[model samples]
Each structure stands twice: as C-alpha cells, then as structure tokens.
Target chain A: MQDSEDYLRKKAFFDSLLTIYGRKPVLEALQDESIPAYKLHLAQSNRDDSVVRAIRDAADKRNIEINLCDRKALSRISRNAKQDQGVALDLALPHYGTADSFLNSLPASFELLALDGITNPQNLGMIIRSACAGGIDGILLPQKGCAQVDPLVIKSSVGTVFKTRILRCKTLHDTLARFREAGTEVIGLSSHAKRTLSDIGGSGCRIFVLGNETHGVSDAVSRISDSSVRIPMQNQVESLNVAVTAALIAFRKQL
Target chain B: MQDSEDYLRKKAFFDSLLTIYGRKPVLEALQDESIPAYKLHLAQSNRDDSVVRAIRDAADKRNIEINLCDRKALSRISRNAKQDQGVALDLALPHYGTADSFLNSLPASFELLALDGITNPQNLGMIIRSACAGGIDGILLPQKGCAQVDPLVIKSSVGTVFKTRILRCKTLHDTLARFREAGTEVIGLSSHAKRTLSDIGGSGCRIFVLGNETHGVSDAVSRISDSSVRIPMQNQVESLNVAVTAALIAFRKQL
Candidate 1:
C-alpha cells in the first residue's frame, strides 16, 4: 500500500514536469533551457546504447531524476507500444494565449495554417512541427474531426510541439470567415482546382486550409476559400500523402 | 519429409513472387500472362471490406489462387505496413527498357525527377507513386546509392512503382550530364538557391533533382545542374520532407 501510494505521487509529480517521449523529441527538448524536466524514464534495457547514454547525460545535466522500468511500463507511459527504445521524459509544454489572442499577437506579415479534418495524430504532429519550422504565426485546428495534441502527436513533432502555437477553434468555417473578415486570404488545396498554386500569388497574411487525408477539404471550407489550387500531379497515381501535401502547400504559399 | 518438400516448394514460389512487387510493373507482367502466382495474400479483416473483396473477386476472375492471412502476416509482406486494409496481390514485376530507350519513348513535354542519394525505401516508394500521379515520364535514381524497387517500396508506392520507368544509372552525375548534353534542362532544388522554383521558365523536357533528407544534392550533382531553385518556406522551418519536397517540385514543374 505504501509502494502504491509512492507510485501515485511519483506519477503526479512526473506528469507536472511535462511529458515528452521518443528518443529524437526528448533529445531535442533537452536543448531548450526554458523547458524544465522533472524526471527521465529509461526502459530497463534498450537496444540503442547511444540514445540511452544521451538521455542519461541530458537528465544528469538538468539534475532531473531517472527511473528505469520494464518495456511494458514504458510503453504504457509513452503510449507508443510498438517501439519505445525505452526512453521518455517529463518536460513542460509552453503555454500560449487563446486562438484569438494568439492570432492577434502575430505580426502583420504572419500566415497561419488551418487544419479542417486531419485526424491522424502523426500527420497533425508533423504538420505542427513543419508549421513551427516554417515560421507560421500559429495553427488553428477545428475542435471536431481532428487529432488532439496528444502524446503521440507530441512525439512525432520532434519537440516542435513545445514551440508552436496551436489553437483549437469551435468551428473551422466560422473561424475561416473571421480570418477573411480580418483581411486574410484563405486558400484551399485540392487536386480538382483549375488554378495552379503558382498562379495564386503570395500575400503578406494568408491561411492555408488542409483537409482530411482521403476526402480532402469539406464543401463548407471550399465554399469560403478565396481560391482553390492544386499541386499539379501526373494524373497516373491517386494523390500525395496528406501530410506531404499540406507541407507542399504551406511551404509553397510562403514562397 | 513430404511436408518439408512442400514447404521448400512454397518458399521457392514465394521467392519468385517477391521478384515482382511494384504495382504498375506487376500489372504489366500480369498483362503478359506469363508470370504465375501460387497464391494471393489478402487481409480479409480490413476496414475497407468492400475494396478487399473487390480485389479478391478480380483475382478470382483471373483464375488466380487466393490466401487469406491475418493483418500481421500481410504487414510483414508490405513495405510501409500502414493498415494494408486486407489487400496484397502476388504478382510479377515487368521488365522495362534501358534509361535511354525509356527516355526516347516519352513525349515532348515529359518531365523527369532524379534523386541524389535518397536511400529511404519509403521515400522512394512514395516518390514513385507521386511521380506516376504527377505524370512524370521516368525516374532516375543512382544505381549505387538509391533504394531498389523492393516489396516495401512497392507497397509504399501503392503499386505505382511498377507503372513508372525506373532508370538506375551508375552515377547520377553522368546521367545528369547526358541529359544536359541531350538539351534537357537539369534543375536542382536546394534551400540555398536564390532563384524561386516559380522563376524557372521552361516549355521543354525538364529534370528536377531532389537531394537526400539531411544533405541537399551532392556537390557533384549540383555542379552540373543548369539551374538551382528553392521553394519559398517560412523562416521558422529549416526544410520540408524530401518526399513532400519532391512532390512540390514535380507539381511545380508540371505546371
């Protein structure tokens, strides 16, 4: 009973430190001084010897606690049961203002990426990482029909989740309309678009709407788009992966 | 002893089937009707139940043998292993002509994509898929450094690996030189390039070189490039995924 209570208190303490898992992300997170870590969880045995050492060194530098656990326990904590390499970290995610406030805080030339219905956490995580790297002002994801910024999303983001501003909007359509009213040009990426991405010139402020993996942008989003454009494909294969497609659009629009 | 012999025969048959895994390449072989399949593996428990059934029914119509396996076994055979959704066809990959002959066979406005030391099989597979969709005439990969058209590559390609002409050259530099000698403009996509991808004006056959993930194009390959261009990205991000970058280049060139 004492051990169980100790475990519970420890869990709560670790949770408060900021949870980061996966070798690449945790390693990246350690580079930032503002991000504090409470403890490190190293799977009792790990195949990657170098990664294990690196994690230990980082934890040591931060003066953080280290806990060694079984693969099953590590898996349960990391939420990535397939391949954990036996490493996880408790690092705090930086706080950001609300969606409206975050947007208002951006400079005039800033652009934002709005995800309509991207449900894959990996994809969403990657998009967030890419958005942060691309220097977008913030990302606005719909409250419904999208992957939440969960642990899996955080891991795939390579620690960019800590730096990027992600806002969850109640309604994507309404939010997009507000952007339009606020003088932001909204562009929807679609294969069916008659206009090529090159034809639609770049502007100071814009919102690129990325849709679901299979069906693409909803009709409601499409109806409000200032323009719809496509990344011209060879017409032989179906389409590029949603994440890849989103990166192309987001990157190209900034170009 | 009899069971052992049967197992050996099955192993030999599977080895033979493994030879032809790319979708379009395998389709061509199937059209030839010379390649024989002992059995087709299908994940009968996929969410896309109808699609799997349709594929099975089509195979049945072709008088091909069918084998129902669990998703795990099916994943073992697939390259990317993303929810194969109960579908994998045991077909032979067709042989194509040399790069010169393949190039000669193309139309005037054909665009070709070349990869410099892109060893990731998943990226290669997806690039082939996207190339086929983008209507690229052929893909030029370095014989020594690039990923071969393996089963995993085919699976990631969604079968488009077979449909495209894959030219494996001894050296990308030499192949690129030959293309330049043949009056085909060679363009390199690099983050350092001052010219935007949109700035390159061309109406003839074009080849775009995509470098590896970490290192852009090798110095040798970049040296011979007639033009080097960059996809404008927001300053926050360092680079786009190689596959996504390739797709954007393909689409931009197509436009």
Candidate 2:
C-alpha cells in the first residue's frame, strides 16, 4: 500500500511537466504564468525580432533562464528545429529521469514494459498512453535505437507522455540484467512460443519486454528472459502491434 | 465445413485486388502487366507532362481503361487529388463489397469486426492489419462516417488491405439492424461494461463492435447490440485504441 501511494505521488510529479516547442507555442506557454516554465532554449542565430524580444522579456520577468543554443544544440533539444521556430521550453519533470533510479525504487511487486527498437514516434506515443492507462508500474524506455521523445510523440500520446511513468535508460539490456539480478522474471512477448500466457499462471511481478514492429523481441533481451509466452490468438496471424500487445498484457486480469 | 471452404475461396478472390494511386506509381504498376489493373482514373486537366504522358502510355500498353474525370470526379475517386497527381488505379476485388450481402451469406458461425464512426485512416488501416492478421471472418466497415479506404490507410496497413475481408456498408446503423435480424450478437467493446470479456463466457457468431477513438460506440448501435462487453483494463484507463480493442476482441481466444 505504501508503494502504491509512492507511485501515485511520483506519477503526479511527472504529470506536472509540459514540454512545449515552437516560438509561438512557447511564448504562449510562457505568457501564461500558470504554465510552468523550467528552461527555455533559443537558437543562437535568432535575430530577436520583436516577437523574440518579447519572449525574452517575458522569460526575464519570470526568472526563467534563456539558453542560447547553436543550431545543432537547439535541434538536439527541440528534435524538430524547423518547427521549433528558434525556440523550445522544457518544464520540470522531477520524477521522469533515469530508469536505474525508478527500478531501484520499485516496490518489488510491479509490472514494467521494457521496449526494444520501437522506431516510430506514433507507436511510442500510443504505447505510452496505453501503458499509463493500463496502470503499468513503469516503462523502461531505452534511449538508443528508439524514437526520441519529441513533440510528435507527445501529440500522438495526446499529452499522456507527460503523465505516463517514463523511466529512461541508456540501454534496455543493462536494465533487464539488473531486473534479473533482483529476481524479477523477464518475459518476452512472442507469437511463436509453445506456451500461452495461461502457462505463466500466477500473480508474479513481471517485466513484459516488447519488441520491434517487424521483428519479435531482440535476442539479447530474450536471452535474459526466464521464459517466453504467447498471447493465444486465432486467424493464423503472427502477432499484434507492439502497443496492442502491450495493452493486452498490461490489462490482463490474471497477470 | 463447406461454409469454411466457401469462405476461403471468397477470401482468395478478394486478395487479388490492388488499389494503386499516384501518377508515377500507376505508371510503374501499369508497366508491369503482370500486376492486375481494373480501371485507371485520370484527371481531364492533366497537361500531359512527360510523367503524365508516360502514365498514359503505360496504361495504353496494358489495355487498361482510362476514365478522363473532371477535377471533382478525380478527387472523389482518388480521395486526395493533390497527392494522387491526377491518377489512381483500382485493381479487381470482387468479394469486398456490400455488408448486407456479406451478412446474408454468413455460415451461421463467424467472427466479424463491426466498426462505428472510425474516421482516422491510420487507425482504420491498423485495425484492418490486426483484423487480417488475427484471422477475423470479416470487417463490417460503414461508408458514411468511417474513414474511406485510401492511400494513407493502405500504407499504414502495410499492403494487408488487399488480403483482408472487408464488408462495406452504407451506414453502420442499417448494417447493425441487418446483423441483429440475422441473429448475430452485436457486441460493443466499451470500457465501462460490468461484464468483462471473461464474464461473457463463450462466443457464438459475434460481431465485436468497435467505436470511435473519442466518443466510443454510438448510442444507436449500442441500443441494437444484444450485449456489450469490455476488455477488463487496469488502473483507470478507460479504453484502448479502437484498433487495439478490435485486435483484443478479434483475436480473443474462444471467439
């Protein structure tokens, strides 16, 4: 019960952050003091037109620091410099940071969706919404070889990205290794497994490792999984979308 | 057993159709005579650019009928005349037609996905892919409020559009009426139903009704449904994506 309460508080903390991009959107967000503004990024090349100047003035009044970033740096932060309109803002999300921290703080009985090679931003966003709605404990999202967290993902998620329990990691392999060390059974979702989910047959804390759209779970992640289970399906269909599969598992009553 | 055999033959026939759009792509498809071509729609305003000329020439070589349509007519057929580049080709798909006819021919037992007010083409495409992969008997897609079959939907379906069994309806209300008259249980997949899927027990000739992304199953259709069931979800997540819900229901193990 204590862990559940802590999870709610942590989720509330992350949900408060609003990362808005684009000059006009950021300006609007900044002008509204109710909207929390953590850090503002501006392209160094921005000529500070009247609108830009007004943005800087608003930030000055709010005591929000403006970081003039090089083109590459701004693009890195904004993800889409063309649409960023020479500006971006990152609101605070104290609870959403390192996967290691989140995993270490786990209450021992929880469900996690560890993704591998999910490249489409839309799929990533939809997955986040489903995971959050399905009440998964936390999402272990690897930074590399996956779609970067950006505005498109946010749009696709319908703003659920901020509310979802996101635990960022350098790589999922290391996180899975640690979870294994802590005695958590890692299960890879595959359509080919002889055993169906019913075979797992118990109320146990599990990390459901999802994989690429075309390929099943990565070999490295599967190698560490205690076993693999398939969703019993008809129609000779091979598999469901990673996000759909995630929804099914996250909401599975007996899981 | 005979009905199953008939269903297989009907599916095989529908799998042959290939709807190709765009001037360049149509030309390429026409050039490969091995590829099927039912009809070619071309805008009357086409100025015969070298590309347009090539498309016309390729169609000519393939003995494919060319319908010189006005801008409005072309746009209606292509759905997006701007991107269609004044050209669209309809390949043969004899089995995919009126939902009324499909319902009339049902074999007393089947699984169908009856969609209500699904407008997003991507969602429509994804649903088709999942339905096809999960081996649904047929998809009852109403023409009035649902997303029209288009290039975006095709791309999102990853070309599974051709192989899937699609039953087009003039309006979902009328279609639901017909299904009810035929003794098919119209099962609405809502998030609020007291009867979880497990509580519903065995399925028999179920047409799982999937609703809009936001509004959910329309009232008219829900009234017609014999009973409504829900995929028991976790946390407070109200619902899964319409496509994902379809996948869960369409592929649900006893269905």
Clashes counted in candidate 1 amount to 17
Residue-level error in angstroms, candidate 1, position A194: 5.9
lDDT of 2 by residue, A1-255 (tens): 999999988775655454568776677667877556788888889996998998999999999999998988988877776788888898775446667676667674888888899999889988987787767877888888788667777667655666577888888898889988887889888887887765664466788888898887899888988888888755445666777777767656522
Q: DockQ for each of the predicted structures, in order?
A: 0.29, 0.31
Ten-residue region with minimum lDDT total, candidate 1 chain B? B18-27
lDDT of 1 by residue, B55-160 (tens): 5555676788777778788777664365344455665434332455455655677678899989989889878876777666778877778887766686688767
Per-residue lDDT of candidate 2, residues B1-255 (tens digit): 999999988775654454668875677667766556778888888897898888888878888898998988888877776788788897775446667667657876788898899999999988988888767888888878899777778667755666677888788888888888888778888877877776654547778888998999999988988888887655545667787777666555622
- C-alpha TM-score for every candidate: 0.65, 0.74
Restricted to chain B, the TM-score per model reads 0.64, 0.79
TM-score of chain A of 1: 0.65
Model 1 - which docking category? Answer: acceptable
Each candidate's interface RMSD: 3.2, 3.5
TM-score of chain B of 1: 0.64
